[model samples]
Target: MSQATKRKHVVKEALGDFVTPTEKQQIVKVTGSRGNNLHEAVTARGVTFLVSMPPKFRKNLWIKRGDYVIVDPIDEGEKVKAEISFILYKDNIQYLQKQQLWPEGFTVEPDKEPEKAEETEKDEDFSGSDDDESDLFVNTNRCNYQYSESGEEDSQEEAS
Candidate 1:
């Protein structure tokens, strides 16, 4: 087929519904690019290795650091041990998490709620202050001028 048709097909397949990894495939977090369509990634078990991006996904899909992808391991390569099969999006991650298929190391903690509550309390406490010193540094550089019909300045006022 044409190049455009191939790209469209690859993109559609990459973005299609989430599919669970097979026996030989596993999820990995991309660490950095290794050049020549090769990427360095870490698996859920903390093993680091290189993965090759397929030609179809080379330009159609862009993978970056911290992005998760499912990789199929290769038995022949020494340095490049895997090939990326699918790139995970937010929805796909959530779906995998819901199905209990997501790795525990990749789960996000919900510890920010208490921090947000503390910040709101601090803001409320500061809002109750009536100190006039807070306005000591008010901007006084504004100038408003009113012009008459002749275009001459009639009056000038300094905005507070």
Candidate 2:
């Protein structure tokens, strides 16, 4: 009888599972792609930056706008760009959420649409009567917010 030896295979672990992200890496939301291996993304802290895709990433990962990704900054200099390190997936997001490592304001709430509608309904159903509605509108126009140009004032007024 001939016996065959079993081979042990090395398995790679997913991000946030067996291994945690490095300090240099930051989670970012892909706002849009600028084409030519470049993309516009925003960090969890609301910092906007442009990220570049290297040949390896471009070939390996199928990235697109509105995808969450982990990036490592090129350097601590004037350049406001990073290298795409990991493309976030559903399982990765769930792992982050479970570990409480997910960034604030970036939580993927399952029932966001229903929650938003409930919040709107709650806002509309204020206990105070219509007579007290005017009191809720606080006007701070007297504050020192001078508009340099008349056009600026018009735009600001229109925005308010």
Candidate 3:
């Protein structure tokens, strides 16, 4: 099978326990590229955020400007930033929209500045410590995608 086909199959098998987004995780639209795995995005409420792509997504998913993505904010009192958790594929976005589960009022107006209050709100939404941030989602990068026909046990175990 091709790499993309394998990835899709694995993603389907692994997403059995897909967790829905909480209030903290907001859907944002990529406004511009910031280079080095970072992109400028605007939240549904028009909050401009600096979104960074985690190495896992950078390697596995293709993200581009104007694409809608899920972002989890990482605020440390100095500057506001977010890590891209899920890249919204067209089908995923369509499903969310069809179910009316999409974040309300999502827009990507250009050259918009995030207000101070909005920035503070975003900061407050990120109450967890830095360590907790990494635990929010399962890291699929460590999964073994290759299948063995013999059904033999391997030295390493995949996370279920």
Candidate 4:
């Protein structure tokens, strides 16, 4: 088959309905890429190992650190303990969690990031400041006054 056709098939498979892992398959979080098709991943049980990405997913789908993937164990290789079978998206992750198929060790901490950002923004409001002027210009030099809208320079001393 042509490369384009193969890529289409791969994308279709990835975007299709979420597939539950079989008995021998398990979900793992990618830790790092080891160049080529090899990736370092850690299982829910805290085991770290290498997994190989299938050729179809090489250019079609990109996997990165913190992404979850379903891996099928291999009986032959020592270093590459498994092969990546499926990549998991947020929707797929939610579906698996609802089904109670997700691993307990993998906490959904990413969802809390937005909340933390909101809290930081609230803290940066500077509502308690004593000065009536805006805090943004508090540290700027006051001598550099711009010309007024009438195109006339201000009375403040201009820098040489």
Q: How does each model score on lDDT?
A: 0.86, 0.70, 0.70, 0.89
Q: Which residue pairs collide, candidate 2?
A: none
Instruction: Give the clashing pairs for model 1.
Output: none
RMSD of each: 8.1, 18.8, 23.2, 6.7
Q: If scored against the real structure, what TM-score would every candidate get?
A: 0.68, 0.55, 0.53, 0.72
Best by TM-score: 4
lDDT (tens digit, per residue) of candidate 2 on 49-133:
8888765555445678778888889876364579877778778877877877777867654547579899888887875435666
Where is model 3 more than 4 Å wrong at Cα? 1-19, 107-160
Model 1: ten consecutive residues of lowest lDDT: 151-160
| Superior candidate under lDDT, 1 versus 4 | 4
- Name the runs in model 1 displaced over 4 angstroms: 109-160
Q: Which has the higher TM-score value, candidate number 3 or candidate number 4? A: 4
Regions of candidate 2 where Cα sits further than 4 Å from its true position: 1-19, 76-80, 108-160
How would you encode candidate 3's per-residue C-alpha lDDT over 1-160 as one tens digit per residue? 7678767764563343233467888788998888888888987777787888876555556678788887787977234488878777657776777777777675223224367567777787876435566556666789757676663454334422
